[model samples]
Target: MTPPMTPVCAKPRRRRLAALTALAAVFAVLATACTGGGGTAAQDVQDSYKTLPKESGKPTDGGTATVALTPGLSPNYIYPYPPASANGTVIARGLMWRSLYRPSGEGDQIADTALSLAEAPAYSSDRKTVTIKMKDYSWSNGRPVTADDVVFSLDLLKAALKESPANWSFYTPGQFPDGVTAKATTPDTLTLELDTAYNPSYLLSMLTLLYVMPSEEWNIARTGGPHLDHSDPENAKAIYTYLTKQSESQSTFADNPLWQVVNGPYRLKSFDPTTGSFSLAPNKEYSGPGDSRLDQVDFKSFTSAAAVLNQFKAGKLTVGTLDSSFITQIDALKKQGYHVYGAPAPARFDPLVLNFENTTNNFDKVIARPYVRQALQHLIDQGGYVKSRGVYNGAASPNYSTAGSGSPYPPEFGDQAPYPYDPAAAEKLLTDNGWKVVPDGSTTCERPGTGPGECGAGIPQGQTIDFTLSSANTPAYVGARDIAFASQAKKLGVEVTIETKSLNYLYTNYGNSFAPANKDKWAAQDYGPLYLAAGYPSSNTVFNTGGSFNLGGYRNAEVDKLIEASTFGADPTVLSTEVTSLSKDLPVLFFPTPHTLVVWKDTLSGPPSSFNALLSFLYTPELWYFREQDS
Candidate 1:
């Protein structure tokens, strides 16, 4: 076959494709954005494909999919704002809710920071006040996305926390520019004013999380105190605080339509947390552009690696994510005639976050030693981990670099700062750091001030560290966590322990919120393998110091300085340099990130490339289509 055409970056907006009934025809325009250029080597590997057996050639428009998922979490009415981080709310957002801005476009449109809305923006020469033109789009309730919708969403998110203590913390610094305010100048026109000239490049990508909701629906739920009113300062603060403070994982009125509205491709049909399954139905009211395949996308949840593999063996499972323990099952899956998915996911850095604020105890006191942590990373046998786990075709990789290799981070840097596995360096560092070799040659690190002569206490014979990973109660997660602990810690002479809990308990009590009273909340954190679907913007919430998402207590005056310079400084080179510098330094101990797999019964068609499971999982749905045998 001839080499495929290379994709090129087109103008911010390509000519919109005229409406077409053919599934493939509808997406021809969408594919135009792909531009034939290959992404990173990792992307090339994940996107590898072969011709299917045969095309049914049928344009399928209906079918029901059964999914495996954790069920029975309470819903937060703040739909998009609530924790889409979990599968329960994630299914809803992907199915029912749509955002005002999309990763590639303002929302459902193409991504072009300059030409944003349908018509070009009418920016003042000063670029301080900018006006946006709304599209001829409507919510599932048949209401249009007016300037008020934008105003309401921004102000309501700020207000929801006031009405409900449990809210989403999605908005802050990099996300919403400093000293900026939004309001509806007219029904179709939305205007925004900033205190300073924000970086258009970064600001544009950061706006992807902005979702518009009907003013009435948002106001009714958020302002439980006052009647419907305009989006003004009098109400903005109250709403912003309530929404920001809300505990979405345990919200009471999460799934109510009084707040949830569909303006995107599909609508939420039903969900059974007990069975770990979520069902979505197509929305007849959906009028957004592009081709949609499959009547709905179903998520089947499973807590145990064994269960997910079992379901895969049962043939009912179409998509899945499992621990490396399922490494042996890849062959079984292929023998049974199933496609295996693999790739490094985005926005994931299984960072070994050190608590800078914890002045007393430090489980990683020895490893946190600058040179020590760096040496330990080199000791990680990424290839061995893959072969042992037996991931998709032995396809898994170790995350050596902090800036995601093929991710929004620089691809060149990975190759440039190559730190191949070196166990020798690890042992040498231990020897230099006052660690003595045992009679048989086994090595162990010693604590600084504990010997009888030294502070009149026995030395911490060997760095025996206790780490507690407080995630939701799930057998699969625990299994994965334990696997890494046993292997990686064994190499470093550290005995690591695992602790798990419920999402509500962990997310609320043990998390970065207020400190928890009992040691059960969390002693130390060990989390992993990030799955980010959305492209990374420099303004990541988790990375910002003193930011709400700063859960793991990572702080560095130098790192913060570099981050600050990158934020305000112009030029991608400077940004790349600083971000690259951070990736090199031991900010976090990153492990491998795997892809999010999506599978259909071989009757559906999607984009030429499949996406990795990411922070933004809703991106590729519009690229999928169904073709039945009869067609």
Candidate 2:
């Protein structure tokens, strides 16, 4: 019975001055937001890496913070496509627009830390220029964050080829896209040069993921607003064809004043998305120098993880993402004390793209035999689906797909990852890939099913294998792929069907079309989990089996030469051992990584850590507050 307290939504002071002029087009994508450096993980309270980590376990002020949201998504396009896109819209766009770069945490060098908001960039000895220097600060609506608004939002993310510009992640502004030789050598000084010789620690790590802007309210929104001008690159294929037709409209992100921006420290004061709820407040013209003890916060939105556990058991969402069936009722919510926090949600090792020139299946001949998709990864169960999904224990890990970022799965892919679960080593790698068992344990197909040019139609004869699951995901991903096809894949013969849709027509008409010149317009996608990103060649927009972020059209040639040699690797640890041998072979059916579970209200606290929806929930909302109004 824990969920009562909730407040927020009072706005109207002339819509907080038109929400402070809709935060000037979120600094017009803040000179293309990509910065890095100390935003948390302890740093003497780093004070303001935009927002989050100010009050820690105490420091309340005047109650009010409801937050839970969800329902045809939006709190005005919250961090639109990166900065960890969604975890309650990255904590409501990290309390309304943030990114000048922040992310060191562990409390930056500790000596009571928290005070480096700026001071990390400095490259040029032919490592291809860099410079940066800003941090004089001043925006919630006071203006003036400069370094020419972080080099005009890094020249509009090097004019939108943007794979990961959080300032330099090893420089690939599409290899200097005939631009970003940049300037603004003053107004807080900025530089950047480059023609080659990459990684000045990727522009000092885009200050923990750069997001700054305001150079004339963002180069007058590169003119694509009413017409063309964002400096005009022949209007980049007509503003990506008018934001792909207003991201496919429904009144495009509520009259897009570029989804109401603010430049962090809190401000978006009202939202409803038919009740995913929202409201934030603080910026009485905020400019940083501390003094915001929580005036109002509210955020609701719950459609079932059993209505966020029947609103935590008839209480009404204590606040944000939860339910692994509430971890054995947390000893009755800690004998009614109610801080119950849980974990597990941290998966995205993202694989599953198999167009085999447009599917036909018996699980498309055991995913075209990649060691029988590495013997269905030793019969996956991942600790009984992370204890039937209630999470928190070792907060999830097992994501193998050919490991990356200096590989060897070190200190990152935990909870027994990459290839360990083992059902007789996946029935000895599917009877050494020829496959035949058949006495009762079903197997058969020792090659030879499809005729007309190998594996594609009518697919059957039974030893069983079938697959397909995307009826537009999230009823907890179609009940965790219908309990991994009725509890651990029917003794490995496997069968799954499902198809359900309408998550806005599966994320804008069949989740980024992999290659279906109209196969009844998509919805057969069996599993989902992807993020194969760490910086561009962007696997030719996600493994070029046919680009447009290739949702499925898989094609292999040795997994496209180990995803193009793990995208420009001089050895990011041999590209993390080729992303863990391409996820122990099952190009797709290697599930179990789904962890985003966050639940709060122990009286609010902060800085424990975990977020990858590309991040912004003010990247740390100044490490939370309100512990019974500071003790």
- For candidate 1, the lDDT comes to 0.47
Candidate lDDT values, in order:
0.47, 0.43
Shift of residue 557 alpha carbon in model 2, Å = 12
lDDT of 1 at 631: 22
Measured by lDDT, the strongest candidate is 1
TM-score of 1: 0.73
The TM-scores of all predictions, comma-separated, are: 0.73, 0.32
How well does candidate 1 score on lDDT at residue 206?
Answer: 46
lDDT of 1 by residue, 299-382 (tens): 665534567667778887654454443544555666775555544444444444434343233443543456556655665455
